[model samples]
Target: MNPKWLTRAGLCALLAIISLAASAAPAGPPRVAVTDLAYEERVSEYFRVVSASSKSSLRASGRESERDSDDAYSRRSSGSLNARSESNYSSTEGTYSYIDRGEMRKFTADIKGGLIKSGRFELVQGKPFTDTKHTEKLYDIIARIKQGMYPGADYVLFGSINSIEFRQEANPIDHTNTVSHTLSLELVGEFSLINTRNYAIKSSFSAMGTGQDVKLLTSQGGRVVLNRGKVVSEVSRSLGEDVARQVEEQLTGVSSAEERDNSYRPRGESVREEVIIFK
Candidate 1:
């Protein structure tokens, strides 16, 4: 055979294989836009809750009674005692929030991170939804979709916080003179994935996360420090992951967490609860 003719034949065969492989490749993963979780701007509650086991609240009531904890100029009850001398004890309550409007995205960000980490979908930046608490501006999910809040996204993962709570408890540890302080935070949220084109919901689920910080205190009315930011971050991250996993399972019919090997935990990962001991 002529060398030039043989070389031409070999080139033709290589091109044919390349063309076939290209055609056989699967489509790229679906693109997703995870919106910031929506919530009602909480009515700031000005009130004091005290209990025999809640020394932290007692101290908070005492400090807040003597000083203005919020400089944001919220509506406070007059009986709430417009900040008096340190020696005065005022039994007043006001309405305010423990969280700010700007920080609510931590929950949404967690779920987005989890979905991205799973590599099951491509996540995109999403625009903010209207403040749900303010009725002056009606919430129109369809209009928001039409405005391209999540441009170039095939689906939208919408989430809303249903309930959130924080509490503290203190008790004497057994066989010791020390007191145990435990601070607990819990958050619950509802989620749904909707097809942007037809406005159909593909999947819906709810996820909850809880975190606790425990420390030992001296019996001398010692206080337990509360890190609202730290615990919120921890809970949001775990909550996001849980929501992401649930979304994946629901949409793809994968195995549930209970059906899998739940006992296996990777090394170096932080646990949701931590214990601190003080003698």
Candidate 2:
């Protein structure tokens, strides 16, 4: 064989081997960073404890100056206090937190686990968000992604609590004086998956989780405490899984996918929680 011909054949053989190896090797799955489940709560009911000057202050301030007589017999001392009639009270401020930031991770616990279990994508840790200005930043998926909240991730899964409610009721038993103290918790959330490189929304959906706790009280006046931890855990688990499943279905093409929809925007947001305080 000619030396030039052998050299060409050697190069061809090397190229073929490289091609074969590339074809046999499996491609890595897309990497995804599941963001913190952001949420905004509106004040459904709230109690404001305003401490103004005592009501007595108004009476004293409104009292007219009396003309004094030049005799001690005309003078009498009234049992009035030295309290100022002017309204002077500071606006009461209280620290409010529904759940710990660390515990908030529970909201997306099952989503992370489900993604791992499915073996469909590589999971990465999304960055922790700080409270800047307002809670709007918490659920701003686009802003978060642009801020590198999902570093080294090909996709980002953004979740936020849309609404959550707790309801309580008391009902009497059919044939007894016993009453049932029932507490029900329900939460709804929305999610969006976006391509980190292009910021294209790959998919979006909403999911809900609900739980209830009931106790039988012997008398109508009996008290009951609802199982908060158990209910929250149940809600988180169920909500996370539902979000994860929809994500999987949309990403893996198991169902009709919402692809390349450029006009998609994240959902609207609401404000603070409502709780009462008495002192």
Candidate 3:
């Protein structure tokens, strides 16, 4: 065989193998967009209350009467004197009250801050749906985008705070006015993934997270107390992250399944065999 012919044949075979490999290559990662989480209908401002106990004591009651002898000092200036009387009374009572921890505290938390572009998908920050009536805006935004847009979002994720609970418990440790209290905050959220084109929900799930703060109350000053507002924000952010993470995991799993399916296809086999032959 002519050496030049062999060289040409080898080049043609290599090109064909390269084309086959390209055809079998997995698709690029999907684009995902996240909307600003919506607040539930019954949502209200967050708050906390502080309370302490004290003792009250009252002195005993007393009555006294006094009379003076008129003739005892009758030498120089004898004068009539009226009798005098005095009375004292005392009473005690104990009461407990819940004082509102009255400093208006504020905190800002972004639940989706932990999400970033990562393996198998590109995360995109979309216009947040902050209003109660945000569905119209979201659908309109999706409608404006052209189909098959390169690197365009294939799915949209929506999340909302489903529940928020705040509670405080106080326990007295001993008689010396020593007390301990625990503050708990729980947040629950629901998340949904929708197909961008048809607006059909592909997946839905719920996640929850909790945060707690504890303090010991004492007559001794300078004991640190946890801020209730901060704890609520922290717990809310935690719950949001949990929900977002589950969505990411689901999307990643779907991508992996697709890759697995592709690997078992005949094109995949052809690519593998050609690469091995070339090697």
Mind giving the per-residue lDDT tens digits that candidate 3 earns over 213-249? 8888787756567787767777767765676556655
lDDT of 1 by residue, 227-247 (tens): 667777888888977887788
Cα RMSD (Å) between model 3 and the true structure?
19.2
Candidates, ranked, TM-score: 2, 1, 3
* lDDT winner: 1
Model 3 whole-model lDDT (C-alpha atoms): 0.58
- RMSD of every prediction: 23.7, 17.6, 19.2
List the candidate 3 regions with Cα displacement exceeding 4 Å: 1-19, 42-120, 130-151, 174-177, 221-224, 228-233, 248-279
Per-residue lDDT tens digits for candidate 2, residues 53-169, read: 543442232333455656633433454435544456756655444432211555777778767765667899888787654555565667878887788899988777777899889
Off by over 4 Å in 2: 1-12, 42-104, 134-139, 220-223, 252-279
Give the clashing residue pairs of candidate 3, or none: none
Which should have the higher TM-score, number 1 or number 3?
1
TM per prediction:
0.60, 0.63, 0.48
How far residue 253's Cα lies from its native spot in candidate 1, in Å, is 0.6
Residue pair clashes in candidate 2: 41-271
Clashes of each: 9, 1, 0
